[model samples]
Target: MLKKSLLLFSAACASASAESVSVYFGNGCFFDQQHTMVTRFEKLLLKRSGSDVTSVSAYAGGDSSSSDLCYHNEGEVEDYGKLGHAEVVELFIPDDKSLKDAAKVFFEDFTQLAPGQWTRQDVFDLGPEYRALVGIPGGVSGPYYSAIVEANSEVHNLNLKEGQGGDDDTIDTGVVWVMDSLKFPAYQAEVCLQFSDDNPAFSEPYSEKYHSLRDALFEEGTLRNTTCPTNYIC
Candidate 1:
């Protein structure tokens, strides 16, 4: 049902209105994986999409934050997993760059196997948080959805959903589920995770230190509430 080609993207771009569009995307863990795509897309798409692109790591597609808190292990009540929150990257796209571009970079590129490997082994965990998702401001329908999808059709040949993004736990068959981002609000992850490693690249060819402090934090646990090794500061 989905086409795989990027050629249509040019036409969609031409017919698309001049107004800007902001979108959110969640494909996998936003740690160093999909997180890297944000920076890459920003460098290339910032001119039209705006300079405020962000890789907002979040807990989404679940019950309710009011029902449970985030950043903690699975619990009987205060668990993100039980809340149905998926590990997601809430992208702030100010322009309609087409979901294809976002999906391509987030799913296809910046992988552990290799760039364009399509191995579906991009993330370290499997859960709702790692599900592939694309969200428009209103919802995933109407002219805006068609416009972005049409724009995305440009790369239908590339098979954005091929191998189902290498995961079977999708809302749809190998396709990134499109929804109204407003409806499925994202609970922003811990602030410390967003703490930059002061490195530009997070992939293989990129810097090798993207996970330094963040990794340290992961080991410590909680929001900046960790005790570091004697050699390091928490």
Candidate 2:
């Protein structure tokens, strides 16, 4: 009986291993409120994915001030450096069906919360940078949600390097989400990832994606309810 029980346990472990899928999330530098928002988002994702999911990870980091600089002769130099702040979120799905189910749930949940102007395809295409910049009041403009969708669509098919630009043909399946809230003097942010590891070289430059997303989100008045941190000073 003991031997039989041990065999059963081993089989269960193997079954679990066969069904798991990995996911990652990255949140570029942000304050406390932003962090709370990201946590909530992760919880929601877990709920949608269900029990078959195995693991979850998140990466969070960002800078207080805009790193843009001016050069007399050269084009305007935008530094856009990160504060080396980041968090990671990861989730493991049990099988292909579970992965698809989780994605569907993510899309539905995201669409429900975001304004009617955006769709799942749009959000997926936006990537992390685009998502962070979304709803910012006075920020730059770019294809925010669209880029995310595009990246996600191809994430499963590519072999991503830590920091390389030539893989554009493959889906750039990495992202960093940023959020900020001034209330309670709280400065917090969280990062989530669909990938396995943290490659600063690749992720550092990805901060621009958050910058763009933040700009767009602010422009839409989505962030008006939140206050900027006095310490960060924009």
Candidate 3:
């Protein structure tokens, strides 16, 4: 199936008309134990959506397996930089679909992890200043701000599913969904969001800070209402 998927992706890439969007996984590494999780999510988006969405992974670290990786610096560097090692997953969305809606679907599904996984996590709707700092473009007027949600377990442990490792190994980790714009017309327009944190999830005011932000985003429509598709996978 993996080979088949790649072939299909290649064909899609060859086509002249294909829309694209980039999703930055802050503190996210493709080689981590949970790498498959994001890949599966990517496939799901394409399968369920009306558009032909193909994705590619870009890493900000050495190719060596033992190299340092994680979201060490997010939004602080010129190149898709993060505080820790991270991966930028680019999604090519078909022209027929709204990139906004496609992104909404990805976020909605991500937050739907197993009950235990989400129960302790706090979600945040980033403020305008931070939103603009990342990639989400817009003023305080529209529902354009991005969301930063808490991860239920330690960065390393969270990668594995329920039974893969000790299920109880949970920690405070932050992830966000961002939207950006593309400069040239090759793929036309582009929007990207980075899910990043500085290992401050367990920190004093930061934890409380994000929870409060989550509440505000919901109220302001930054994190608008999204219902899961009847047969969708979380």
- Candidate number achieving the greatest lDDT relative to the actual structure: 1
Give the alpha carbon lDDT tens digit for every residue of 3-49 in model 1.
Answer: 11111123222333555343556655556543455456754755322
Candidate 3 similarity to native, TM-score: 0.30
Worst 10 residues of 3 by lDDT: 183-192
Cα-based TM-score, every candidate? 0.58, 0.27, 0.30
Put down candidate 3 lDDT per residue, 1-234, tens digits, no spaces: 101111223433553244433323222222220122223444454442112323333332111221122222333322222221124343444432334443443333333355434312222322211111112222112233322212222121223221110012122222332323121001110111122122345332223432243344233332222221221111
Off by over 4 Å in 3: 1-27, 31-42, 48-53, 60-85, 95-234
Which is the winner by TM-score between candidate 1 and candidate 2?
1
Over the stretch 123-180, how does candidate 2's per-residue lDDT look in tens digits? 3322222222111111112222333344435433122122111111111232223122
The Cα RMSD in angstroms, rounded to one decimal, for candidate 3 relative to the true structure is 18.5
**Mind sharing the TM-score for model 1?**
0.58
lDDT of all predictions, in order shown? 0.45, 0.27, 0.26
On the 0 to 100 scale, the lDDT of residue 54 in model 2 is: 24
